[model samples]
Target: MMIEAAAKMAQWLRLEDGFTLIAHTSPDGDTIGSSLAMFYILTCMGKRVQVVCEHIVPYLYSFLPYAEAFNTPDTAEKSYKNAIAIDCADKNRMGKAVGIYNASMLTGSIDHHKTNTAYGDYVLHDENASATGELVFHLWQHLGVAVEKSKTALDIACSLFTAISTDTGNFSYCNATPGSFRAAAALVEYGIDIAEINRLVYRTLPIGKTRLIGYVLSSMRLYNDARIGAAILLWEDFLRFGAIPEDVEGIIDYIRDVDSIEIAMILRQTQKGDFKVSMRSKRYADVSAIAGRFGGGGHLRAAGCTMQGQPEAILEQLLQVSTDALGQ
Candidate 1:
């Protein structure tokens, strides 16, 4: 199904000469990987393809293929034939690039989020796919573009691998399916260094990040006899640790694994003084539904929302809601 869809999209895209692929702000491996893969494939076909996102590529993901080719909306050329949004469910998540999408001749969205808005003229969303990269891989086949397996092009494979591995919790999450593994196997066949990618993404945290984690762990609170741990990181905490928003990325996963804990929440302060809440569940907590009540959405086990007011209040609301949901 995805192959057919990608092939259809490729056919439509090939009919045009100029286009742009846009990703959401603070991109993860899936966002970067899917956008870059599409960019590489389109560029390979002699099409003028540019990748754009709100922020510059992170240091860790700069190694992706054609990282230098990504543009900001401010610098992107005018009047693209189409704009492809990858790995993002909603346009607001596109941040600065949202305007480009609004102005495009055509807009297409490719994502794996259940909460997707179906925003584009062409919407390819699969709630079950491990990552948007997997959907892109399938889309390539549908577009009739065969992935040329080679050691030199392993960078593409590595990008896809990282996307899937991260999104699926290294294939342990429920989203990991047979199709997901097939894609992983194909990526591994390219002879990419999975171990190195893992180390870079998961192991090599800066000192400031470590200190930030220390602060988070120290400030953790439990909602039901240690069964639910919540950690709040205000703007002040980031300043104290010399950290940034991205440094708080994976801390909730640590709390989710505590022996008795079934749910965990991480609250961070955004630039607007509002709080961004991320929630994770060990099993059956329906965090997505919980996030939805607050205008955020994601998977059943992993979801998030951005809220107004102090982090403490946001934490209190989320904990109360999650606790109530768990009780039901």
Candidate 2:
């Protein structure tokens, strides 16, 4: 069935021109990588392809191939005959790019999220595929796009490596299955600089982000006998350290590290005065279901939602849910 979907997507790409590919809002490694992989593949096939994301590619991902090539909604062409949304679970998650996606005559989506609602004319969703990059890799194979022969093979390798590595927590997360390892091994055969990529993603951090982490650690609170940990990053927190949204990317992991904590959460105040809540669970708990209650969804252990509320109130509500999920 997956192969059939890939073949269908390949057919669409072959049958159409003027294609536009979209990544999710606040684009992450998987989304950006999948989008770029498709961009390179389509471009190689002599198709006119454009990639767009609602937010800037975070500084950490600037090293990716064609990272700068992704246009914003304002810069992308208004009309496209074909569209493919990569790693985005729903249409609304396409953010500003929804206009372009919806305008396209033929639309499809390729994703690896379990919660995906199959939103497209053609949808290929595999909850078991570790990362969307894995699916994209297979799609490229099904299309007979030889990585070794393609000029953009290195770029494809780097993008897929970043996508799978980051999404699986550097191969440490439970989602890192045998297939993830196989995919990573294949990408490694392309001779990607694994150490450098790790340094860029896991080790490199700006002073501002360091300070922000300190602030968050200093203020983090534990609840339900340390079964739940919560932190709040107010707008002032960003201003104080000259931090950006990307700076808060991995802070929730620290909360998850607390001994015996089943759930961790971070509430960050967005520029729009709304709070973006990131949730993580060390085990058993289904954070995605918790996030869905607030109109958000993601993987079981990791999920997020955005709501308008004071930090305290939001934290209270999330803690209630987290504890209840843990049966504590």
Candidate 3:
């Protein structure tokens, strides 16, 4: 069903022009990579395409081909013939680009999240897909953008590789499937420097990030008899390290790696005094349901939510829900 949807959407996109590709807010590798892959494909075909996201492309992804091409919604033109959302499960995730999506004559969505709301005029979702990049690879094939012949194939391959590699934790996560490895193999055949990409994304972190991670971990708390680990980074913590939100990106992974920890969570305070919580589960817990309680959601193992409250109070609320989920 997802393949059929992708084929139909590819046909529609082939006939469309003046497209705006929207990525989700606080965009991750999957969102940025998938969106850029579509941008390159459409641009190579002589279609006018603009990629928009609420936040700047993080410095970690700056090395991606055409990373600088991403535009803030405010800088985009007022109108587009069509809008396609990549890697976003819900319309709200479009963030500021929701305006562009709403203004377009037609709208579509492509995503791999199992918790997706199926919101959009044309929606293609594959819960089993390792990453949205995996689906985008098939979409490109359907659109007849022959990887071997297209001049832009390298850029598309790099973007897709970043999307797949990061979302799967460098293929270490359980989400990494046989299809993912196969897609990655195809992308590597395009001559992307895998080592360089890995260096830039994982090994090259700013000193601020190092300090921030140390602080976050040092102050972490264990709950429910060590079944859950939680950490919070206040705005002051970011200020101290001179770190941005992106710097906190993978901090929860460290917590999740601890033995006997079934669930791990990290909360960061936003400028608006709201808390953005990211949750990860090793096996049993469904963090998506916890996130959905606050009108946010993502995959079962990883999910997030935004809420307004004092830090301690929010932690208490989250702990209660998490404890209940763990049947503790």
Task: Give the TM-score of each candidate.
Answer: 0.76, 0.78, 0.76
lDDT of 1 at 57: 86
Of the candidates shown, which would achieve the greatest lDDT relative to the real structure?
3
lDDT of 2 by residue, 129-227 (tens): 999999988887778775583558888888888999989989998899999999889888888889999999889899989999999889888888878
- Ranking, lDDT, top scorer first: 3, 2, 1
C-alpha RMSD of candidate 1: 4.5
Report the C-alpha lDDT of model 3 over 207-247, residue by residue, as the tens digit: 89999989878999999999999998999889989998878
The TM-score measured for candidate 2 stands at 0.78
The residue pairs found clashing in candidate 3 are none
lDDT of each: 0.83, 0.88, 0.90
Q: Lowest-scoring 10 consecutive residues by lDDT in candidate 3?
A: 142-151
Task: Give candidate 2 misplaced runs (Cα > 4 Å).
Answer: 147-151, 216-240, 244-246, 260-328
